[model samples]
Target: MESNILVIYTGGTIGMIQDPATEALTPFNFDALYKHIPILQNFNCRIDSYCFDPLIDSSNMNPSFWIKLAKV
Candidate 1:
């Protein structure tokens, strides 16, 4: 049986990449996930992702984030 995994991106270092030009942090494109994480290509399960419209930084996380995540 194929398992399933849900990757919820709440936005933090895990989902950020530094822009070499400006040296600024930016949201990593989840669309090209395989390019970043080749290991996922070997997975034998379905992987789904949910990214917040406006990613909440780790420092800004609170109870509301958990509430919202639970709702999803």
Candidate 2:
């Protein structure tokens, strides 16, 4: 049987990379996540991802965010 999994990335060090030009941290190319994490392809299932539009920092987490996350 095939399975479906949803991956939600809420902005963090895990989703960041160092910018070679500026030597600063920035959001990594989410589209290339599967390419970077090839282990995902090992699963016989469909994978999907969801990212926050504005991308919230962990320090700014709030109840509304939890609600929105729950909805997703």
Candidate 3:
């Protein structure tokens, strides 16, 4: 049976990419994530992703984020 799963990116190396012009780490385009990781297509389930509107830095991780995550 196929299952649906939500993948939330909480901010980390996995969610960052080096900007070509400035060569600095920045929030990646979450919309294009599927294209970058085509392996997800092999799964027999549906996968969706959610990224923070104003991506939070890992240093600022706190209870608020956890509370929101729990609600989802």
Itemize residue pairs with steric clashes in candidate 1: none
Compute each candidate's TM-score over C-alphas.
Answer: 0.77, 0.78, 0.75
Best by TM-score: 2
Model 3 lDDT per residue over 1-72, tens place: 999988788778878899999999987777786797889889898888888776677799899888987886
What are the lDDT scores of the predictions, listed in order?
Answer: 0.86, 0.86, 0.82
Off by over 4 Å in 2: none
TM-score of candidate 2 to 2 decimals: 0.78
Sort every candidate by lDDT, greatest first. Answer: 1, 2, 3
Per-residue alpha-carbon lDDT of candidate 1 for residues 1-72, written as tens digits (9 for 90 to 100) = 889988889888878888999999998888778787889889898777889988888889899888998998
Which 10-residue span in candidate 3 carries the lowest summed lDDT? 49-58
**Candidates' RMSD to native:** 1.8, 1.7, 1.8
For candidate 2, the per-residue lDDT at 71 reads 94
Ranking by TM-score: 2, 1, 3
Better of 1 and 2 by TM-score: 2
